[model samples]
Every structure is written in C-alpha cells, then in structure tokens.
Target: MTSDQPAATRLSELLGWRKSPDPGLTWAQVEDRLATEVPRGVKDLSLCFPTGSFGGWIHFYNPVQSERALDMFLGRAKTKTENFKYARSLNHAEFPHRFHPEEGGLVAWGHGDQHTYFWSSQPGPESVLYCDDHGDGWGQYPGSVPEFLHALFMDELETEVLYGQWAGCRFFTEFPDYAG
Candidate 1:
C-alpha cells in the first residue's frame, strides 16, 4: 500500500533491476530536451531500470537513455491529445479528458497492452492514472510511482483495464528471450 524505502531501492529489491552503466541523464538535460518535468520516482527509475519491461508486460521509456524513445513518447502523447479531444467531442460524458499535455493533466510514463500509465502533474495529492485503448476503461492508482509498482508486483493493484496483459506473469527485469 505504501513504501517507506527509497523508490530506487524498492524497485531494485523487488524487480532486481540494474542501473545503466552509462552516466544517467540529468534533470537539466531532460528539461532542455523534453521541456517537461519528469516525476522524481520516474527519474529514479531511469537510474536503475532505464528502458526495460516491467513484469514482462509494461515497457517504460527512459527519456535520458535515447532521444528516439523520448521523441516517440512525445509523439504518442501528442497523438493522444488529438484523439482524446475527438473522443470527447463525440460525447463529453463518456470521454471527458483533454489528455495530460493539454491543461496540466497527468503525464504518461509507461504503457502495456491496451493500457497507458500516467502521473498527475497537478497540485494536491499525487497519484497515478491509466486508460485503456477503448476510452471506456479508466482508473486511478494510489501511491507514488514506486509504491504503485510494489502493489502491482504484490498483486494488490486490481483492474481489468490492462486486458489481462500481465495475467499469469511474474515480474521480470529485461526483455524475455527464448531464442537466444
């Protein structure tokens, strides 16, 4: 439910993730390039996991690791903005979001099959949010980024928005390789 440990520590102990050997990306670099303030936990995550799959399901983009990945995420977010606006136009009651990049909304951090994870950039209590591809399945996640992940690894965070992408899968650190 909550984590008293540091975000990186919890992530390492639980996921056995290793930080990249290269110099980690700095806040200045991110700000200069992305022009968006990434969450602290997310920054910490890059120090360790950088770019990797979580539980063999979700792929986290490490902005500092590659410009292409960062550009891809930005592009996706931009596209989502237009798409969500169109969805809202269809029916404000059903699709009532302007994406995060619009009016100080949540910033997307990662995504899995049919699900995208976001962090609230607004004031007040911090929390996470996710929306499925259908635009109908949406929900909030409690805790900081690390805590949310801990809950997810422990099978405490519940929702069908992921469309069972993580079903029957235990948390693993890198890409799953069978052929190699």
Candidate 2:
C-alpha cells in the first residue's frame, strides 16, 4: 500500500480497479440537500468506483447512481440532528458541534458499526472530518473522504472511535443491489 497516495488511487490499486469510473452525478442536488459543499475526495470516489463497502463495513451514500462504481461510506445525520436538537432543546452542552441546517453545522457523510462520520462547513476549506463513536465519544480526521479512508486503511490515522479491526480491512465488496 502506498501510504502517501490518495485514497482513491490507493483503493484502485489495491482492488485492481482498471476501468475508468463514469460519473453520472449532479453535484448541485447533493450540495443543496446537504446544505454544504461536498468534499473533493468524495466527488472523486464517486467517480472512481461503484457503491460498495470496504471490509464489509462503513457505507457512504452516493445518492446519485454512477454508471461506474463507488464505495460504501457512512453517517446517520438524522440521529445527530435529533441529538443536537435535543441538546439544544434542553439547553444541554452534550454535543460540541451543531447539527446541519444550523449554520456551519455538521453533516453526516458515512458510518461504521457503532460510529458515524461527519463534515462541518465550520472548518472552512481543509476538509476536516468528525466521527461520533457510540462507544468512544467524538474524534476528528483532518482530510477529505478518501484521505480519511486511506489513512484508516493504512492505520495511519489516529482515532479512538473506528475500531482497529475494521480500520485495516482493505477488502472492497460492492453492494449486491447496487445498480451502478
């Protein structure tokens, strides 16, 4: 594995991805729905592969079907929406970040078995990721989607959330029902 390579490239090489991924997506629809700019690597991933999972875990929703392929990513935004909303309702300081639609709030991007990954427009550009692990609280990943996945796959990322077992599971499995 090339430690310093981009996640998309690394995954492609690892999986012997030879065909070019066709991008049949509309970015505006995604951005409008999420209320934020989609990270660059995410767009790249969608363009690089099919909708699938790495290590039989972690799913990323590529809402628009691509003629090519994309990998599975994660997040359950509505939960955090409720979490932050409830926190706000009770005037509780439980969540450090605000949920999306709250101006620079967090938006769910992917998820693992017990954790959810997120991105916040608050950080401006640099593209930082936030992971809320059900068992370990929250942690941050400073990069785009592929970067995070690549780092996690390489065990180069520091997180108290994503389990070590799942982190290095580099095997990619395409979703059976995926049409793309």
Candidate 3:
C-alpha cells in the first residue's frame, strides 16, 4: 500500500502488458512513455481527481493550485508511517460530454448531490456552456478551468453512478452496487 510498492506494482502491470520481449524497459521507461503519449494536461488533472476507492477526494484547482495540492499530498504521504500508493492517472477522454482537458468533470463536496457538472459543446449555431450535463455532445465553450478547480479545492463532490447518457462512457464513477 505504500507509494513504492504501488509504484512497482503499477509499473509491473504496465510493462507486463502482453509481456514485451524487450527487458530493457524499466518502470522509468513506462513512466516516460505514459508522460509522452498521454496528454500531459489531462493526465495530470486526473491525478488530482481521485477515484471512488480512495474515498473520492476531489481537489479542483488551476495548474498552480493543482501543483500546490500535489506537493502537499506527497508530503503528507511521505510522513505517513503506513505506505499507501494512490491510483495513477489514466485516459478518461471517452466521456467527452462530462470531462475535458481543462476543468475536470463535475466535482462537489459533502453528502447528497453536491457536485456540479459542466460540459462544452456546439449547441445549434453558436457554442454554449452548460452547468450540468446538457446539449447534443460536441464542440467547445468558455469558462475558466480555475472556477471548477477552485470550487473542488474547497469541497469534495459527491460521486455517484449516473445512468442514461453516461452508460457508454468508459470512465464513470459507479457505486459498488447500483441496480440501475
């Protein structure tokens, strides 16, 4: 559960993909490949947004804010007597209607429906910005990623399993048991 153990396990999982013949690739190589191939902005953002298994802590912040949080989290992790490795960033672009490169998906803190969702898409002739899930799905709009980021920093969005529109998207936060 420590950072080193999880890092090694994750690295092994990545390298073990199909069991590559080249033994030269190390964990560092895997990290480099992930950094280069995946979009840095999105990948970094995902790291800031922890999934459900990790108590669903959402720290929304701009680039600067994100770095600050990351540093603090790393520091705290280092101080801990128990070693725990948090989840690594993964590709989450498939749910275009919900997530984006700038502001991460809807993040709200506290119990109940506290999270606010946002999506940029081409609505009719002009592009529009939506507070929650809306629009046909596609295109870009405006709104500082800092807005959502800051809000997330202050609060933790209540994660839930959304059916309907989000059914096909690969990156969804589903509860352990949800009939629907």
Candidate 4:
C-alpha cells in the first residue's frame, strides 16, 4: 500500500479484518507516560485495531487502554531505555542503538517470535528498525510504522531476518481479553 492510503484500510484489506475496534482512549495519556510523541499512524493503528497477533508471529503491543493489561504500549516504550542500556553493556560498544531522548535512540513498539520492532527517535522523520531474535544485527525500513507493518505482512517487503522468524501468513488471532 502507498503512504497516501490509510493504515486501517490497507491493513484490513490485506488481513481480511472487517472491524475497526476503537476503545476511545486518548493517546495524550500514553504519550505523557512515555515522554515522547508516538507517530500518528502508529497510534491510529493501535486504537483502531484490537490486540492480536498476525499469523501468531507478530503483535503490535496492547493498545493504550488495554483492559487485559499485558504489553501496554507505554510500559514497553518506557522500559526501552533501560533494556537497551543493559543490552549494550552485555554486547559491545558498536551495538548501534540507544533509547529515546538520545540521538538515534530506539523506542520499542512491538515484538513477537523473538523479533522486535522499534521507531528510531531522531530529529527528522522516524523509521522502523527491526532486530531479529533479539540479536545484534539490525535492519532499517524507511517508512512509517503502519507502512512497515502493512508491507511486511503483504510480502511487499523483503526482510531477510523476518523470513526465518515467521512464515509469511496473514492470519490474525485476537487476544482473549481484547475488547472488540
């Protein structure tokens, strides 16, 4: 799908999802908690869709007002700084990633099948960063969060690491407590 297309529309078409389930939660609270602004499309996607896994392999974190309380977006993003610091210490100096508020720091958004997705928090536009199996290697997708997710699930993007983590399947399974 193109950037002109709305993420919910493209994703619904591609995934055969028929509902746009919004819980009417404002993003202001979530953003306040993170101390960083989440991309519009990313917030829209989270709010518009129910909590679920794609092909049981990838999951956008639970929405801001998730009732089940697992994997809340702000919780994950807030912990990124600390997690990355430890990761850098355990690994090496050339690890090449920092948490938000620092130049080129990364904000963790989603993870599944040992693969993590992040937004490179910088001065200009944000890009999706992918790390496979929590390994040292990195891949950058120069697009919005929705675009990366849409393309990844649609087989329009070739992520070498993704191929190993998941078979390209579009099946979506909603979480049991996902209010729809």
Candidate 5:
C-alpha cells in the first residue's frame, strides 16, 4: 500500500495481479508492429500484466489482446469498418477528451463498462487519463502506468475519478485469451 514498494508487489497484495507465463511482448516488438513509439510506462505495463482484466469488468489491451482490437481500431480509420464501430464513434474533441490515434493524440490502454483508460501522446504532467464515456471529464490519473496502478490498487487515488462504476469493488487481475 506504499508507493515506496514495487508496483507488482503492491498490485499483487492489493489487487491480486499475476504475471502472464508467455513472457509477454516487448515495447520494441509492439512499436515495430505499430510503426510508432509507445510510452515506456505502457511498455512496462504490458510486460507486467498482459491481457489482464480488473474486477472482471475492465480489460486492458496488451500485445495479445491488441493483436485483433488494435488492428480493428486502426482499421476503422481506413475502411470505416464495422469491425470496430466503437473506434469510429469515438470523438476525442468532444467535451471529455479521449484517444483519437491521429495528430499525436491519446491511445487506449484499457476499457471498462463505462470508462476507457488512455495514455496521452502529448507530453504533460500526468501520463494517464480516463473518460466516463459520457460527455464529462473525469480528469487524470497521476504517475506512469505502473505507478498509477500502484496508487490505484492501494486506494491512494480519488475513487470518483479512478473507478467510476467499478468503485467499492475488490479489484482482480487475470490473463485470459484475447477473444476480441
């Protein structure tokens, strides 16, 4: 429950996150595939917990999960395909800004029942942000990916902004197959 401890240890103790056995993919591999650089925080995250779901509600997109979702999300920009209609519907410029994947915009790392977590491409004070899917801004989550998860699991963050619909529930983590 302390920031001084390791992020994985804290997550394991607080939220029951377990690493995947697949050795996971590296940042370089993902970047090479995407043809773009990703934040080191996100890289560390994918290494730590690939294809993890939180509270049986939120699913974080890792290399394996992104294998399909990422392509679909990107494909929408080209063919307006229904394969990822959600991507087509997202408008970052709306009241609550989200990931747009163009012009150096934010990118999604995870999504829950009512919220989606994103990492901003634009350099700023904090690296993480989330929107409630509605037109309201829920502000930002501080620290890098691991740091943010540490704080979040330890209940060190504001509940209103961090969990939304998943608030008050005990967190969970697992590595299920990427069905998407």
Candidate 6:
C-alpha cells in the first residue's frame, strides 16, 4: 500500500465503501444504497458550488411539486395564467402589494424598507432563486451586490435545475494600481 492508498482506504472505511471482488456487491449497488439511505426533500437538496462572479453560494429546491409549492417556495405563480390572475386580483382589490412579471418571472418591490424581490421560474439550469435582504445596492466588501448575489446563489433554500447550455463561466478581480 502506498501513501495515497491509505487515504483511499480511510475514505472507503468512512463511507462504508469497499471494492470487493465478490459478485454480490458492485459499485452500482453501493451507489443505490447511498441514494436510498439519504432522504429527499427541499431542505435536503443542494446546488453545485457557484463559479465565476457568483461563488461560495448554495441553493435548494422545493420538495413538493405544485402551484402552492411554486408560490410558497419560489414566490412565483405556477403558470403565466395564474400569475395574470393574481396580478388582476391585486389590482381590482387595490391590494397594498403590487405584483408584476419581469424577465419571465414575477416580481414584487414595494415593501416597508425592504429590498425588491424578483422571482423567475425559468432560471438557467444550475441557477437557483433566492431573496437577499441587501437588495441590488452595491457596496464594498460583503455588502456589495456581487457579494449578495453570491450569497443568494449559495443559499441553502434555493432550488436548482440543469438549465441552458454551458459556454463558459469565469471571474476575475482587479488589483489597485501601485506606484513606487
């Protein structure tokens, strides 16, 4: 056994994964066991770590699939018709809260000192939806829009789906000029 061998062995023991030549046990069997043992729910879901401008973020999806789930979790109507109906009801009822659809999503902005909240049903695959208290305002350090975006993307409550073709994702930070 080599140095790397010990690490692999240790990992296998920790995960109860062993590479035995026995016909009764296969890699696929191990994977199936792991999946079955793990419970499924919105709270248990997770998104891939973000890349590019959005990093260090997490996302989750709703456990149930229904109009109520869409409204409660994503904060958007289940369909365009439902969204229109909701909007119309708000308008006719003269409800204090106003609703609108933007970028193929439902949005509500006017609230007491609260940042505008936008929800899109068609977020790109791997993209998750979330609300940030900071709003779109950009500031230096953790208060910046980029940081907030990162936070929302990384939120544990966001749902993820594989959307859109991947071209490439990249991010870069510039350094201040230094003259000696």
lDDT of 1 by residue, 82-169 (tens): 7667877987876665566566666777777767778776765667788885687788887667667766766777786654433355
Please rank every candidate by TM-score, starting with the best: 4, 1, 2, 5, 3, 6
Error of 5 at 17 (Å): 3.0
Q: Rate the local accuracy (lDDT) of all candidates.
A: 0.65, 0.63, 0.26, 0.68, 0.57, 0.26
User: Positional deviation of 75 in candidate 5, in angstroms?
Assistant: 7.4
Please give, for residues 95-166, the per-residue lDDT of candidate 2 as tens digits: 666777788877776665666677776756646555445323667777777777766776787766657754
Tens digits of lDDT, candidate 4, 120-179: 767577578887646646788887777777777767777676664222577677766655
Which 10-residue window in model 5 sums to the lowest lDDT? 76-85
Give per-model CA RMSD: 4.3, 4.0, 18.7, 2.9, 4.9, 18.3
* lDDT, residue 108, candidate 5: 66
User: How does model 4 score by TM-score?
Assistant: 0.82
lDDT of 6 at 32: 46
How many residue pairs clash (N, CA or C atoms closer than 3 angstroms) in each of the candidate models, in the order given?
Answer: 0, 15, 10, 0, 0, 7
- Which candidate number would show the highest lDDT if scored against the true structure? 4
Give model 5's clash tally.
0
Q: For every model shown, what is its TM-score relative to the native structure?
A: 0.79, 0.76, 0.21, 0.82, 0.68, 0.20
Model 5 residue 5 lDDT score: 66
Question: Model 6 residue 92 lDDT?
Answer: 42
Off by over 4 Å in 3: 1-41, 53-116, 119-129, 132-147, 152-180
Candidate 6 ranges beyond 4 A from true positions: 1-103, 106-119, 129-131, 136-180
What would the C-alpha RMSD of candidate 1 be, to one decimal place? 4.3
Itemize residue pairs with steric clashes in candidate 1: none
